[model samples]
Every structure is written in structure tokens, then in C-alpha cells.
Target: MRALVLAILAALAVTGHSATVKAVHAEEREGFKVIVHPDNPARELERGFLRSAFLKKSTEWHGETVRPIDLATRFTVRDRFTTDVIGKTRAQLRSYWNQQIFSGKGVPPPEGESAAAVIAYVLAHRGAVGYLPASVDPGKARVVPVR
Candidate 1:
């Protein structure tokens, strides 16, 4: 049994399956774009502030109510955003939201069914901020720097 397990691990390493999986996920994350309504005056956001906004800890931006948007949990871009930007995995975020709900402190951001929907919401709402795949043209929305 030990030899069988070692052989399987060797095969996986030789085939680079583990590394390939990580590479694919990282490639998918490369095209994510963070955006806000063009009317929003802020050009760039600090990463800490962006995380706070999405986490629903900071409710306002420049004195206006902030409307943070999210993609559905199943989306790859959402996974990347959660992991790379929010510094939390999907499961961690779910747990966080559950705690918030039970405590009556906050709720998760509204989820967009698709990237197009997210962009549309950001463009139409004055205080909206969301992310989309880089392939989408932002139109009047302004891309916010995550860093």
C-alpha cells in the first residue's frame, strides 16, 4: 500500500498535474478588472479599503452609500477576487457572512449573475463598485486600481 501511494504521487509529480491546476487557476485570475461608476470621483482605491467595502465593513465612500457588487459563487473571477483581493477563500467568506447574519451586523454584497450584469449595475448606479472579466468593455465605468 505504501509503494502504491508513492507510485501515484510520483506519477502526479512527473505529469505536473498539481502545478498545472494551479497555473490554470492563476491564468483565469489574470483578466479580472475592478471597476466603479464613471461618475465616482475616486480614481483608485487602496487594497485595504476595497477589501473593507466588499466585506461590508465600510458602508460609505466619500459620504455616499457604497453599493458593492459580487459575482455568483461559482464564477472563477469571483473566486480569484475573493482569494486575491479579499484574502479569503469562498468557504471562509461564507462563514464570515453567516457570522455577520447571525450577529445582525451585515450582509454579503449583491451577486451578479454574469459579468455583463455586474458592469451594467456599476454603470447605472452612482455609488456602485464591482468587478468583471477584462474582455468586457467598461463603457462609462471607471476601472479602479486594486492596489
Candidate 2:
């Protein structure tokens, strides 16, 4: 029985079934809804700015320090946000940040452990920006459209 199970697992691995499973899991996730501190006046953001801000290339927003928060790389919502807005995959991001650290360019934004933590961080910080699963409610926070 053990040998049969191992053989089946090896077959699945050899056939790329794991990638399909991850693809479907990511699709099932609702993706991210961008949220900002309620006091943030900018109602919308340019997508390019998000890429820069998240990368720490643009560090200020409206005279306040840009605090870009993120979900851990394991989350599917994070994958969606990175692909849709940041224009990089998680592995690509890791490589980019690695080079940045090596050259002292900058560091990637901090990551929240959970969706609620992300929302709370946004609410507590003055210039905080983050995302949550689309169905998650960001209490008293503003949803900024990404243009």
C-alpha cells in the first residue's frame, strides 16, 4: 500500500498536477481589494505608482512616508496583487529585493500575517496602504481605485 501511494505521488509530480492545483486555488481566491487609511485624500492611484511605492522607489505619498504593507508570499491574494499591479511574480520579487539589498537600494514592504492584520495596519498607520481578499471588509477604510 505504501509503495502504491508513493508511486501515485511520483506520477502526479512528474505530470505537473501540482501546478494545476495551485492555479485553480489561486483562481478560487477572490484577489485583493486595495485599501488605504481613511484620512488619505488621494481617491485613486496610478498603477505605476503602486509598483514604485511597493518597491520603495517612491517612498512618499502626499508628504507622508509611504507605508506599503503586504500579505505573506504564500497567500494567493498576494500573488494576484503582485501579478496584477506590481507586475512581478513572487519569485521575481524575491530576486529583485535580493539585488536591492545587495546594492543598498531598498527593501520590500512589510508583510502582514493575516487579512485582519493588514486592515489593522492600514487603520493604525498614517500613510499605510495594503490589500485584502476581495470579500474581506476593511472597516472605516477607503478603497482606492488603481488606474
Candidate 1 structure lDDT: 0.85
Runs off by more than 4 Å, candidate 1: 1-29
User: In candidate 1, which residue pairs clash?
Assistant: none
Model 2 poorest ten-residue lDDT run: 24-33
What do the candidate models score in CA lDDT, each in turn? 0.85, 0.87
- The TM-score, computed over Cα atoms with residue i paired to residue i, of candidate 2 is 0.82
Candidate 1 lDDT by residue in tens digits, 1-147: 999999999999899997878965775555688999888999788888889889988878876788999988667778778887899877899999999999998888999998888888998888889998777787778998877
The candidate that wins on TM-score is 2
Worst 10 residues of 1 by lDDT: 23-32
Per-candidate TM equals 0.79, 0.82
